[model samples]
Target: MADPGLLGPQRRALILDLVKRSGAVRVADLVEQLGVSDMTIRRDLDALARAGEVEKIYGGAVASGARAEEPGFEAKTHLASGAKAALADAAAALVEPGSVVAVSAGTTAYAVASRLLQVRGLTVVTNSLPVADLLRDNVADVAGTGPTLLLTGGTPTPSAALVGPLADQAIRSLYVDLLIIGAHGVSERAGLTTPNLAEAQTNRALIAAARRVVAVADHSKWGVVGLSAFAALTEIDCFVTDDGLDAPARAALEESVGRLIVAGSAEDSAG
Candidate 1:
């Protein structure tokens, strides 16, 4: 037994975080992580369920239909520190100088924007506030590298992201060389998914407006499936992920997509 009164709000937040990060979490894992009883975790989940914060499944919970399970921008900014950085570098490598690129909204996308600071004489169009902020913040850091930045104008999401009809319309006008997207989940069967269907629509617009599509994600994004999908593996030009993908994943990528770049670095930290 555990004390919900003592860990009430904190417990809810912890479970929510795990649900978002892991996509779905088992009851037993929650008990161990929170040092709480299964009953306690269930109660916490029930509370979140009543609020319509998450949808309870047989063994776990996933983001609700109304909103993404992802936490606020601040929470995402600090997660998977080394992995995000490594993944970002791998993503940035795919971009050639002077090319027009469209980046999607997500912390991992923001990380990609951070590394793109040095990609001089280029143009970047994005719908992410954090990514725009990162591009502006790192301008000076990019002494020899600078790009012309363009931001999509629209209403912000709960995550303070820009997406809606206006953003979609804005994105529709631009035909870019490459569009790099971020996904909450990337599965071979379900494809690239996100919790918000509207975001999915906007992402689909991005995919349609670009010549080549690249998805930059970490290993955590594997196995989870969201309500809405953006593109099938066949539509993607390249899939850039860490080198830790298992044999099945590698085979799946080979069987499904055109090219899969398992961003192998000299100092690989995929483990």
Candidate 2:
């Protein structure tokens, strides 16, 4: 039985471990194992679902599986907010001033774009409408010293990304110093994936146009798989994610990607 004295985070961690190990965990079983109330177990499950760590079912929570359904941009923005911010900070640190960087579509990529505003002389190419709007609106804040922004014109996706022939063609024509991207799902086998085929193709174009690629995803994205694979894990030069990733998943990413960065660890250590 789990220690009854365990705090909320510790209890949640144990619950996540159980779900990861068995692929699913029934609410009643969790209550019995963790020595928590049924209401508490439900609350924990709700929290985990919000973090994208698990999929809630009728009486239990299951490990995230292949997610072919695409969530709208606004819907995704509310999930994993803390993890996304940490990921954004870490990913933005990899960019240098005056470098031409390609930012892909997603809430995480939009976070990275916000952080990039401090990096003077940057030239950003993107297919994300929010990223473009963010940079354009803040032009005066940097006293006209903000990064030069380029937006690819294409058919808009539900995620607010412009994709298709025009986006692919525009991305392919220019080379970028780095590519900071987010994926609908990331896995060892499937790599970076998305439900939208055209977005997948456009993401591939962004990867091809960059000298180095950095994928910023939260720990919750670890085992999730999407319908279409865009870039392989081997193609990612660096992977930045929050510290919620479990040990096995972390080891797997270390072996697959060129480098793995767990955000928030530094701050945790410093504190």
Candidate 3:
């Protein structure tokens, strides 16, 4: 049992730690473990949920998966920086000059956009405001000429993505040679997923508009499941990720995906 004299913050911290470690915690269990009343435990869970630290479910709380909470775009920019850069570089390598490409919204996709500025005579379609701003502001400095850029108009998401019916409609009418997408979570079971349902639909539209789809995510994305699944593993033409992934996970991806490219590695692995 936890210390009976523990204050509110300390008790809540303990509850959060337990939920994170075990993936979930029943209210009854938490009350007993923390030596608190059921009502008190419930309050703690509510506070954690409001803070985006845990997801509350019937009778309990669960770890904050991508399905439970999505961090803001700026908040995610600092995470896995080197891995994201490597993944972006590898994803950029797949695009040729004069090719039309669609970029998705997310920090990793933003990295890919930075690299695409160097590729000349390209048409870029996207629903990410940051990506549009990045390309518009800096493309000319990197290349003598900038690629044709199109930004799909729609409602803005916390992750800086424009998603909804309007974004889907715009994407459906156009076709691109490639789509470089980022995922909130990646797992064999759930595939590419996002917490936002509209973003999932928008991502599906982006997939439909592309002849070839390449997904870029860091190793940390593996095995995380979000609320909505956008595409299955087999749907991607190529998956580019950092070398931080484990051998077993890499092997599993190789078996499921058409091609698995581990950035920073000496050689690429094909399925």
- For every model shown, the clashing-pair count is 0, 0, 0
Question: Which 10 residues in a row give candidate 1 its minimum summed lDDT?
Answer: 262-271
Best by TM-score: 3
lDDT for each residue of candidate 1 in 5-34, tens digit (9 for 90 to 100) = 556898888778766664555577778777
Q: Rank the candidates by lDDT, best first.
A: 3, 2, 1
Error of 3 at 100 (Å): 0.6
Q: Rank the candidates by TM-score, best first.
A: 3, 2, 1
Q: lDDT tens digits, residues 127-195, model 3?
A: 999999998998768656787899999999999999998999999999999999999988776688777
Model 2 misplaced stretches (Cα beyond 4 Å): 1-65, 267-271
Best by lDDT: 3
Q: Candidate 1 regions off by >4 Å?
A: 1-68, 140-145, 265-271
lDDT of 2 by residue, 155-254 (tens): 9999999999999988889999999999988887668877677898999999999999999999888787665679888888999999999888888888
Q: Enumerate residue pairs that collide in model 1.
A: none
Question: How well does candidate 2 score on lDDT at residue 209?
Answer: 95
* lDDT score, candidate 3: 0.88
RMSD of each: 10.5, 12.0, 8.0
